[model samples]
Target: MNIQTVGVIGAGVMGIGVAQNLAQTDHQVILIDISEDILDKAKYEIRNNIRLQSFFQKSDNRKTPDSILEKIDFSTSYKLLENADFVVENVTEKWDIKKGIYPQLDAICPQHCVFAANTSAIPITRLASLTKRPDQVLGIHFMNPVPMKPMVEMIRGYHTSETTIEIAKQMLSQMGKECVIVNDSPGFVSNRVLMLTINEAVFLLQDQVATAEDVDKIFKGCFGHKMGPLETADLIGLDTILFSIEVLYENFNDSKYRPCPLLKKMVDAGLYGRKNGQGFFVYQ
Candidate 1:
């Protein structure tokens, strides 16, 4: 099915990026959140992001930021999603919050609407089980900066059909992204390893192995990585990193996945990384 109108749940960092990217592709976007205040903040951020992105990438499509923003409808009501052809849910990674959303989305969206869970560590199969249309639910893990990223990690739940996979691929194609399809698992391929690395990085910092700057420098200067694991954790949000690692620990019942105490302390301190201007390293 052709997905022209898309519903985006949550107004957080990932959700705003997804909505912005969809609007740039000329898709009508229904961006839903729990409150008007959050939606209002999301609108402001999307507008700013569009302007900033224009400075970095030149595109043949000359739609101005205002015109792109016009394509998105920010609302607090789930009822507004009734006509959405596709829905990508980017809510918090916690299972309790997500389990409460999928069933509601199933009730509101069209039967053909595919639900894409843009999550970090939660198992797609577990999420799919909450909805009656398990075959239509899959995972589309869009990278941090949705518009700038060229690839996504797509998770195929045990019940997700091939047709659903094709539809997801088609939607990603429209957004100028390619997908690497992988089997459903807690953390999948990317976060399964990434969370461990970030947790270890935190442990290193707690152990005084090196400064955050030097640690990131080694990965960038010596390992040829764009950013070190600590920097990545900061970008992903320290709280988010901690939650993902905890999920992995519980799911695998392993000590290695245990979160560093310092990571937990920082999260408790409300230093959520770039979003809040503080984390492993403070942002300007």
Candidate 2:
């Protein structure tokens, strides 16, 4: 499939970044969300980031902030996706939320259009089963801050077709991203490993074995990691990290995947890291 227009569901951090990146590549985007407030906030952030990026990469003249802003069609209606050549769903990771959206997407989108789930842990096969076009559904697990991440974790469902995978790769390539295709499984690969490391980091904090800074420092200093596991969790949002850990624990029925109590308490207190300004370490 030759994708010209892309549909992005949800107006959260990942959704906004995905829409902004697609727009920066000159693809028309239909950015849908249930809340107008969230849509407005997403639009503001996209504009802000585009301006910030222009200063850092002066050589790239692909888009100005105004051009990127204009390329996107923000809407509250899911039916607006009817004209999209491809759709990327980046809703919250909870099963109930995702379950509700897939059927609506299936009903609204054209039969030939492909559905890509931007989830970290949910099984692509399960999401595929919700729609009539099972073979057309797959996971394009984009990393947080979609514009900065050059690599995407592509997941093939049990019934996902080779044609679908090829088209997915083609679409991502157009946006200047490389795909690492992996077979469907719980958390696939990235989150399965990443979430565990973050969870363990939280354990270290809970046990008072190390300060959050020290724990991240060890990994950064010794292992040459770009970001500490706890810091990564904070960037990903503590609530989201907690949710993924729960999914991993339930899927594997293992204690190793259990979420840290401190993580849950932080979430309960409404401190979801950079988004909310607090998590393991406070963000100004």
In model 2, state the lDDT of residue 117. 96
Clashes of 1: 0
Off by over 4 Å in 1: none
Q: Candidate 2 residues 88-151, lDDT tens each?
A: 9999989989999999989988889999999989999999999999999999999878888899
Question: TM-scores of all models?
Answer: 0.98, 0.98
Candidate 2 stretches with Cα past 4 Å from truth are: 60-62
- Residue 119's lDDT in candidate 1: 94
lDDT of 1 by residue, 124-206 (tens): 99999999999999999999889999999999999999999999999999999999999999999999988988888888899
**Residue 73 error for model 1, in Å?**
0.7
Q: How accurate is candidate 2 locally (lDDT)?
A: 0.91
Tell me each candidate's RMSD, in Å, in order: 0.9, 1.0
lDDT of model 2 at residue 2? 76
